[model samples]
Every structure is written in C-alpha cells, then in structure tokens.
Target: MNEIAVGAHAPDFTLTTDSGDVLSLAACRGRKLVLYFYPKAGTSGCTVEAHDFNRLKADFDAAETRVVGISPDPDKALAKFRLKQGLTFDLAGDETHAMLEAYGVWGEKSMYGHKYMGVERTTVLIDRDGKIARIWPKVKVAGHADEVLAAAQAL
Candidate 1:
C-alpha cells in the first residue's frame, strides 16, 4: 500500500473499538479526525502517547475534533490498556492489520539491532471532508499530542 499523502482521501475503515463498538472513519465525517497509530499497547512509548492524548481530550473535543488510537492489539488488550491508563478517547483494534496497511503504518522496524514487522508511530489528521490534512510519520512520543492538537485546530 502506498503512503497516504496530504490532500488525498483518507482510507476509510470500520474496526471494533475498545468499548465494544464499531468505529468507522466514514462515520466520523463532518469532523476533523485524529487517527494515530502506535506499535503496541502498554509499552513505554505507546503509554506516554496515549496518556498525552488522554490529557488533551477536552481540548480536542472543544476544537470539534475526534481522536482515535489504532494498533494491532486485540480488544481485550485495548480495554486493559485504556483502563490502566485512564484514557478517555477511543482505541480501535486492528488485529487483522487492514487499517494499518490502508494507512501505510505497518512496515519494517528495527529495535536494538533486531528487525521486525510492526507499526510505525504515525498520526494522520483528516479534515471534515475526509481528506488527509496532515501526516506525522515516525513520530516521537514527546509532545506529539500537542502537535496533533495544533494541527487539528488549524484545520
């Protein structure tokens, strides 16, 4: 799959959310969507990212933007992570990697001299018309949510 570019249509998907509800990108039309992809649940980087997003949920809501996290973890794992982290936003499960592939975040990664197939820390901001507004690829955990918030606000 090709990486989604700004001004292109965001690939829509329907996935089971951590709250046991079906979440589709198309369903979130008419609002800015912050779709973030992380490597795994409960990991140090993932946790900090989730927490940061959680902390800014109110601000995002005020900006009329919706935030959703995506990873290959199952719903059960997402539930535990959400509860443990006190996350207020939705976490969607992408166990089949369809969404990840569509967004072009699932790819080769290396850690500690070992290579593996995993999610690249990435975030996509979709405009109200469902077009990709901005993309943050190879994201650093620090101050990421704030950056996303600024982008969403600008859109």
Candidate 2:
C-alpha cells in the first residue's frame, strides 16, 4: 500500500482496545480523531505523551475529538499501562503491527548503534470525513499532544 499522506483518506482499521472493546476507525467517522502510534506502553516517552493527552481529554472532548493510541503491546499489557498511568483514553492493541504499517509508523529503527524494527512515533489527525488533516512523522514526545490538540481544535 502507498504510504498515507496528508489530504488522503485515512486508512480504516479495527483493533482490540485496552478495555477489550473492538474499535473500528470507520465507527469514528464524522468526528475528529487523533491516532497516535507509539513504540510501547508504560515507557517514559509513551507514558508522558499519554498522560498529557489524558490530562487534556476534556479539551479534546469540548472540541468533539476522539483520541486513540496504538502500540504493539498486548491487551493485558495495555490494561496495566492504562491503570498504572490513570489514562482514560482508549489504547488499542496492535499486536500484529497491521494498523501500524497502514499508518506507516512501523519500520526500521536504530538506537545505541543497534538497528531493529520498531514503531516510529507518529500522530495522524483525521478530520470529520476520515481524511488526513495532518501527519506528524517521527514525533518528539514533548508538547506533541498539545500540538495535535491545537490542530484538532483548528479543524
């Protein structure tokens, strides 16, 4: 599949969320959606990002936006992470990395001179019509959720 690009249709997906509920992107159509891809649950960067987004949940709700996080972690791990972090948003379990690939966030990564495959932190803002509003590739954790919320509010 061609890489998802700005102004293109956001790819639809269905994944089991931390709450054991199956969430489909199609079901979220007609609402602004924040699809954030992270490497894992409970990690420092991921936790900070999720916590920030969670803290601003009301802001996003006021703007009529929905936030969904994606990671390769299993449902059990996601549940623990959510509970540990007090995150109120949905954390989708992308065990197969299928949705990650669809969003082009899963690929080769390197750290400490060791190359391996992992998720490249990214955030995609989908508009009401399920179109890509903005794509933040290789995102920096700090202040990212705020930026995304600003874009969603603008939308």
Q: Point to the candidate with the largest lDDT.
A: 1
Worst 10 residues of 2 by lDDT: 1-10
- Give the lowest summed-lDDT range of ten residues in model 1: 1-10
Off by over 4 Å in 1: none
List RMSD in Å for every model shown: 0.8, 1.0
- Angstrom error at residue 95, model 1: 0.8
The per-model lDDT (C-alpha) reads: 0.94, 0.91
Per-residue accuracy of model 1 over 1-155 as CA lDDT, tens digit each: 55899999999899999999989988999999999999999999999999999999999999999999999999999999999989999999898999899999998889899998999999999999999999999999899999999989888
